[model samples]
Target chain A: MKTKVYNKQAFIALQSILVKEITRYFRIWIQTLLPPAITMTLYFVIFGQLIGSRVGLMEGVSYMEYITPGIIMMSVITNSYSNVASSFYSAKFQRNVEELLVAPVPTLFILLGYVFGGVSRGMITGVIVTLVASQFVELQINNWAIVCFVVILTSMMFATAGLVNAVFAKSFDDISIIPTFVLTPLTYLGGVFYSIKMLPEFWQNVSLANPVLYMVNAFRYGFLGVSDIPIENAIALIIFFIVGLFSIAYYLLAKGIGIRS
Target chain B: MKNKAIAISDLKKTYSNGFEALKGISFEVAEGDFIALLGPNGAGKSTTIGVICSLVNKTAGSVSVFGHSIDQHLEAAKRCIGLVPQEFNFSQFETCQQIVVNQAGYYGVPRHIALERAEVVLKQLDLWDKKDSQARMLSGGMKRRLMIARALMHEPKILILDEPTAGVDIEIRRTMWTFLRELNEQGTTIVLTTHYLEEAEQLCRNIAIIDHGTIVENTSMKDLLSRLDIETFILDVDSVPNELPKLENVEYRIRDESTIEIDVPKEKALNQVFESLTEKGIRVLSMRNKSNRLEELFVQLTERAQVVDREQKNEN
Candidate 1:
């Protein structure tokens, strides 16, 4: 009975944090939900339609179809990463994160609450972008299970990574530095616009070192039934990152880094 | 032996920069006791509260809430405390109602129950009318009350408030005092730290004064005040006297033709001073304490502690 009550309270605490996070982003839909949809639509028009026609038949499918999954994955990654980073950092900046810190809620629950909130935004944005992509190109699902698993895992991975960024962030400038300098560069260099098979052997090997490459390729394999790298290898690498980042984020919270004195 | 609501022993906190906020301070607050943890600025009052709330890590110490050690039963210890920090810590963008309800949710209160409790607390705090307004839009007093309302939503066993009425108007401060008094009457233990010594003197049954990162005095309010050897009163006279009246065991100073400052010992009575003034043809129109009685004692005690500290440093 005691454990049951504890679990129920923990669940309630998690729900509260998640609801606050969701409400915050939705409250400013123009800033959060709308921008990604508009950005992805622009990507579809420019890269998928205008540019794909000139550079076609790179993969077995049309260029439009080949990049659709990668585009969706990109939206998921960016939105998930930014959502937790900005929201958590804002909470810290405002000093309101003390609400959770002073509560009886477990640190793990707080961590999961923020992560799930990010995942919710990421998944929502991913679906919106996917819908926009469908208007421009017909999307085929070769493996529904893999697509679901990859998207969820990838969203979780980036969301946890966003929390780590928030834990170490001392200023608003610190929050944006990672996304601009590291995340944006890595996402573009990942297999989003082109497959690694088109690259030289040395360049391909170096590209393989990028974790985003595995996530994008795995997501693409789910939709196109073809990938430059093995699907199992991509899945393994994504899982490895999720565990490592989750542990690091949880440790930061437990140690009260950046938030507590 | 009353049950201990909070027991902190040898609580020491040395910040990374080597500033010692708390230096082996130990104290206990009995259950249902309204205690004032008094201190000047940077006297470790907030730091001690921070450690109890688990908001700041202590370098070395043990804190327990109702027998639950913070190191072992952290969640249990946290569940027992509701803290109203000195600063406005609620999100400025959220509505008052949301802030209160969300705080309740953090303590595992169901949404429905939290809504009901929020209504009760917000209204009790006179913030029901402003519940829908964003927190930033509320007046300073209302914001402070909102934080109090949020802290009370969980119905914590002990409510610790740090300077809850710093900049509040007298009317609002009075109402808050009444509200807090009623809260204490209902068996809720309260620990308050305030620069308003009058507020502390009026609201708290016990007093603990800290200075230089250490507890200097810990005693009941009545006992501490009883230890005051002298009380200074400012007397307003109807007419000026060329020479001040000389009375035994009473020191008098002429501030101006119409006012005189007198220091009366505890054993002396005001009637004796009045009779002497009457004999001297000085009509006393009004009299008031030169300062808050508690404030005078607080200053004296802290200054004494500082002198001791300086002496020890010299010896070292």
Candidate 2:
């Protein structure tokens, strides 16, 4: 169906866009790749060793192991969202989005190219964070499919959201606003360090409202076979959000909301 | 009928802030035509080019490239066009080779083909030695050439250059003109927008001049140039004439003892002036136009458009 929608030119155009996006961050790995690895390392040390030890067992597993999936998911979400948000905003700022707009590339391919760039960064950083976590915790992989599915889907979801943020963003400060005020708080409160069961009933209901909770818990379920919500429900939520966010991103692009004018 | 390289019918664009940049403009470029789209600043030249490339959304009307409607067959329409925008839109961090190769890839050129094409175009543009250098490291003239190189990599049927030599040095500008002339000779349809009337005069066969978001003139270059009523020419004489001889319907002003400027009407004959000058024993050494004809015409049209604007405002 994708091929039917896009001819050979569009396909090649997509590849070119993807290659450019990939090379951009890779060329500056110290800025894009290294920062997250170092930050996640500090998180593992400070939260898992210093504070997580006193916090003790969560769901009958060691605190470090219980929070491992959540921390990794956090990095994936942040990196995926930030990569696209910053990259796309910078393109808009420099007016080079015109290059993509003027090309024969389909709108879907353009969106996919940028989203995949975010996904690539998210997955790479996710892997590095996972490796960092493995050093401190006896990690177990209960369902690899669910792990891969959840990881990819979460990255896609956040990447799409970041694109939407970029479409509406007018300045560099605007790009950072959502990630700081909304993303950071939602991610931290998404049951990363502790399970929602530790919260009172009212707060647990509040935590359930956060979409990121579904992603982190789904990822945690893949690794430990334990989850607050049904695995099927978490999986469905992730898919639903991915579809919804992708549609929104496509609509914004088609309408030429911010970039075209 | 021959295929049109570009066709725009009633194209319109109004920004979200209520700025009407293009107000229902329409024109066409035939295949292989080197046409100049000339206008003063803010006369919607860039907006028109932007709409053709899909960089700006059109509020109404339609555009087609080689029979492919931009609205329905945008990809096909875009495949036929290579646009060099007025600004440096490529990433400053990208190398010249990367920028050009990446542009070729956008048009569906394979990686190897894009690489070869990049080398060829860069070399042709005298930019091969700086291929690996970042774009920001290049001089302004080199940056402008780099944009042209990138645009030509895919070899689109139509190339739209918006002020390709705005701030370039005269030498580089002449080199670019020569290069563009050769490209035009190879049957590439070029539609350029520039403030330099001399560029339009030198390189274009047809021209469409816009003023206040409307086309005031669109015709063949020869037809446009023929519309001038009088042309001023400076004559260098071999002898210093104490008194200048004037012919009927010809106005002459002596610049120096041996140099004189004369305004020759379109209906006047040059031989009459030569006869009169020869009678005075003032032998002519050389003669040339006192100013660029196109520049004079452009100033007249823009000034006339401003008068109309003033009258409309007064009526309002």
Each model's lDDT comes to: 0.94, 0.91
Candidate 1's error at B206, in angstroms? 0.3
**Residue by residue across B203-303, what tens digits does model 2's lDDT show?**
99999988877788889999989889999999998866788886888998889878989999989889898898898898899999999999989999889
Can you write out model 1's per-residue Cα lDDT over A26-59, one digit (the tens) per residue? 9889999999889988988898889999887867
lDDT tens readout by residue for model 1, B26-138: 99999999999999999999999999999999999899998999999999998899899999999999999999998999999999999999999999999999989999999
Give the C-alpha miss distance for residue B249 in model 1, angstroms: 1.7
Measured with C-alpha atoms, the lDDT of residue A13 in candidate 2 is 82
Clashes of 1: 0
Range of the 10 consecutive residues with the lowest summed lDDT in candidate 2 chain A:
A1-10
Candidate 2 residue A123 C-alpha distance from true site, Å:
0.3
- Show where candidate 2 strays beyond 4 Å: A1-4, B234-247, B252-261, B267-288
